[model samples]
Target: MGGFATGLARVTTATILASSALPWPQPWHSAGNAQARGSGRPITSGPNFFTAEEFAMVRQLCERIYPQDEEGPGADGLGVPLFIDGQLSTPYGYGARWYMHGPFVAGPPEAGYQLPYAPRQLYRLALERLNAFCLENWQKPFVQLSEEVQVDLLTWLEKDALSLGPVPGNVFFELLRANTLEGVFSDPIHGGNHLMKSWYLTGFPGARADFMDWINQEGAAYPFGPVSIPVLPHKRDEQG
Candidate 1:
């Protein structure tokens, strides 16, 4: 993931400016300086785990990470932010499945997930710190920054070039970027990849048993189109 940082930096130019169908900028100021609370607030009355401000940030961040292109619709169009919000609303956000013992050591990269904060805590704290940094340095909130400035700030986060107060910038970047990809490529039932646009873009014959015939055709396009599941959420127990 760290090695991919350079590639990420290279690709965010269009991403920073791409807001094909985002639903954030309008609602951001509508809340009128409302700070985020742990109490789950629906983003636009949808099933959400984020406050209005957090949802705004998440939506903007996802769009910047995977903006629309000639290839297809961006994260904003696919509602990747909503997907992330839904995931965070579940037990996964609380890190329920992780071992939360002490004796914590900041060991090597192989040590794996040494942070004390859960996924939910990480996003909340990181966003707070990030907004603070933006206000102090740029005299505005992150969501209000210019497209070029947004790209620069995100690049700084990716490169660990900025001090995000107590929240590690690189860690936050990794989490945000990873979730963006997951929302783009995961099954639509999870609330992203709307219509399986990514599958069509990647030529991935999703869940199709008959795709075996096309395996040998390297250069030829698949004759069949991509298939997607319904918009409903998959059962967590079934996933487990």
Candidate 2:
């Protein structure tokens, strides 16, 4: 992951530098501010994976994971749910990239994912069972629960104390947590981070061409605002 992170930074630097050399439309941005001009645009696509009820649940879950505070926008507002949905519609969601065939061993914690369900299936089953459990206990769906109750339920999920049908609660919680972070921080071109709000919050120069000169400045605030990979329809499809 560290290697990947370093590589991504390098790629970002190269791409941004090359793009800057070309005549391209650059979205105006400012440094040290969480908000960027023309960023944080509203997500336009409808859910391709989750139904309305489930999508609502996902939205709530994601926002709860990274709620709106004095810092900046929360997950749903940043399209984290939509990002997960978009991811589910791709090969990644189907687990096409993984070696699904198994000797089926759960030897230790060090061993990786041994679940039978694909990522898409896990989401569907988890949401359905969670809603059922919530209704049984609280007379409502998880999405309809109050924020306090929702937080309690999420805690139970984190502790693996909740049973949601065939899907392990802890596994679901882990997946949701990971996906939430990915959606919040990943490039907006991948259907999350809606306008690079998180980048701005973290002082990440998203796609800004040249920051080589500023690399030596430690503990100093970035002067140029973050940039992003401009979304082109074909590129989106290709990446997904």
Candidate 3:
């Protein structure tokens, strides 16, 4: 549960640019010239409990995962943390889609998440448990711990060596980490893939009408690798 699934591992140079088997929704347009809906959105920055805490935690964690560098846009630039928050605010995060009905037993490895807890519960317990462990081991809460301590804490949780709770620490880490990558790469319509840094990393072209004219051209490097600018509502029919 902590590591990758068998046969699921495919390390490639391009994650976003690679041909995906994921059934992502089709690209949609942003509302016209409207300012970003900074309001009316449930913040997912920290834990789902308090708005300020969630925001701080997510922002900090995201920056750690994708630090600003000469490479490209960072996680914050891509708005990954915000996307994570948005996702959690939905039924998906609350475990509405999960099989919470009990007679719950620890089943075989293949059974997967047989327990009744959802993301919110799992995180709530995990956070509290991790904080407690931190108080004993490092004398600080998970968020307050220094960067080095954070790594140590993360490592322990990822390894499932942290005896915080039965929340499946390793499984939780992998889930959160994978989703974090999604937020880093998925279409912005889904609210992650902000500046499209993941696309740049993997050399994938995005939603464009055609590559026919450039296909036959040889030798010369294509003028553009494969860029996908936002296709807002006004640009929708332009494809046809």
Candidate 4:
């Protein structure tokens, strides 16, 4: 595999392992939400949390982290930005499930999510700082930068060479990177995994309840397409 594919494999592997340890809530979808299962339609509505400028920057950032190549469609094509937007509108973005009160001292890496800011706040603060950094260095915003420069900025962020004010650049990079993978591999009802392309790529048997018949066939390639969770539409008001 090429460098991009190798890196993507590592990210995807790590994401899968991490996801298995988390308690994922069922997603609620509305009729107005763009369905990406079989249609592969892009989300046309504006973001719920990110402003136009912030959204544009995030879209470019995701694209750079997982650019389209001969392997398959990348983050932008999978509607990862829309997935992130949807997530930021949910309780997870507000850190509702976490224990927020704290002295907020720096903890070891294993402590996990010691930051005071919620996911939404992290994105807002980080994006603002990142844009300022780009304008200061490149005379433009992140979205306006050339693709090569975008990749360089992302690399710097990943390596902690960049800092986003109160938010560490590496923290923001991991958050964005993990979210991008989730958007690519998650069921379509959650606003990504458009047409189950990632599933096809990895030969993942999605939402199949049971694949026991093939369990005994070691090393056998399971000849089947992926099945996504059924999308049940609810009224916008009823979502509450």
Candidate 5:
């Protein structure tokens, strides 16, 4: 589990770095800021995209992927599901930036994003099929299964043993994993990394304007808590 946690941390860092080049929707940034400010509040609202059942499944799946250990909070604890919900409500989930009109040909792995379904559509379809598969085999939905069984089902999905209609099981798994990592490590303004816990866990100095004082300390641990971008009250209200 230590290795798993370490790998997840590394991937989270990579995702953060990779996302720096991407363009984010203005509404998402605003909404993320609002959500970030209320990080202490429990999520009482329903998901922006997923149904209640689908959201439950996502929560369970993400927890399994990044479970809490001696390290710190897990995916749920870090508000990963909320982050995903926020993302799916944005243009990115609709694949607005992608060239959606296509011949829809089956291409090699090198040909990026060959699927016709957007991220939102893919999750909707895949979760339904995954639940059906779980019921057919285990007489229960994926969310109700034991942790070991859930892990086994995830492995099957990763191996493409389970079919998710038009969306490949492996593709869905990869998407889920990537998004989970993003939620675990993305800036609080983007609605994950609640209280900057991931940054603290990984010893990352998040969004700090200047850290030149500690740059020269070789092999020395920096003694400071991670800082998140502050959300102004007026801006939060404006976004609301």
Candidate 6:
């Protein structure tokens, strides 16, 4: 959305999201350079909020969403659940400067979020609701529940059966699930994208400085950017 209005300078230009008159990207950026190396630091909240059991549950949920396979690494490998924890610790966790004022109404799918609760609130409420449902129905915490029970809970949320207070279950599901994917794929500068697996899959050359020469060359192998980092903690080699 941000790029669409600016029109990619080479072809033309139009500013999108005039909310800020600043340039399309901030000056601190590596710009279009793919050499950007992620320090892989967490940006959101720390180990707070998540009890050990809750964290294990999150890991399990993420693994279910993107299981490990020969095709590529899974959500756990990318540190998505950890990324979620960090996001909840950030200002975004407090609802920040967003337009939280609302005479709320349920709208079409495209109407987007109308609630005031921030991500931290969402997680807090959702996890409680999930645990309540688990205890009421299964007599155990979510983390201790069987994989099938976990799937059932997630399915209920996806289908809007497990309603949390204030926030809609589907809304929480979408927000949490979408954030999970975004962190899994985002430029590592912000956090997540542990090993650039998303870039590798999409052939995204990543934040390269000089696509000027290579873009549109059609099917050229991405240089693997000299900044490649191991996607997993165990695979990480500062030298390799």
TM-score of each: 0.75, 0.79, 0.68, 0.82, 0.83, 0.70
Clashes of each: 0, 3, 6, 0, 0, 13
Worst 10 residues of 3 by lDDT: 1-10
Cα error, candidate 5, residue 220 (Å): 3.2
lDDT of 4 by residue, 107-188 (tens): 8889888889999999999999999998999888888888877877887888999989999989999999889888987887
List the candidate 4 regions with Cα displacement exceeding 4 Å: 1-42, 233-240
Q: What is the lDDT of residue 74 in candidate 2?
A: 75
- Ranking the candidates on lDDT from highest down gives 5, 4, 2, 1, 6, 3
Colliding pairs, model 5: none
* Residue-wise C-alpha lDDT for candidate 1, range 44-126, written one tens digit per residue: 43535788888888887877777776556677766678778878878888999998888777778688888888888999988
Please give the RMSD to the true structure for each candidate, in Å.
10.2, 8.3, 8.4, 6.8, 7.3, 11.3
Greater lDDT among 5 and 6 belongs to: 5
Q: Write the per-residue lDDT of candidate 2 for residues 1-240, one digit (tens) a residue.
A: 123222332334334333232222222133423454324334866788899999999999887777765546678778899899989988999999888886766556688788788899999999999999988998988878888778777778889999787777988998998898788788777778876776655656677777778776755555565677775766655544
Evaluated against the true structure, the overall lDDT of model 1 is: 0.66
Give lDDT tens digits, candidate 6, residues 1-240.
Answer: 112111221012112111112222211223443344564753333456577766777777766555545535556776778777777777887779677887878788888777767778778777777777778887887778876666666667779987876767888777767776667666664456665654454444455566567568655544444244334655344213
What is the Cα root-mean-square deviation between model 5 and the actual structure? 7.3
* Residues 1-240, model 5: lDDT tens digits: 334434655455645543232222222224433433335223455677888999999998888888877657788878899889889989999999988988898889998888889999999999999999889989998888998888777878889897888889999999999899889877777778776666656655577798789777764555654567776787566435
Backbone clash total for model 4 is 0
Q: Give the range of the ten consecutive residues with the poorest summed lDDT in model 5.
A: 20-29
Candidate 6 stretches greater than 4 Å from native: 1-39, 42-46, 108-110, 216-218, 226-240
- Identify the candidate with maximal lDDT: 5
TM-score of model 3 vs. true structure = 0.68
The worst-scoring run of ten residues by lDDT in candidate 6 lies at 10-19
Which regions of candidate 3 are displaced past 4 Å?
A: 1-50, 214-222, 225-240
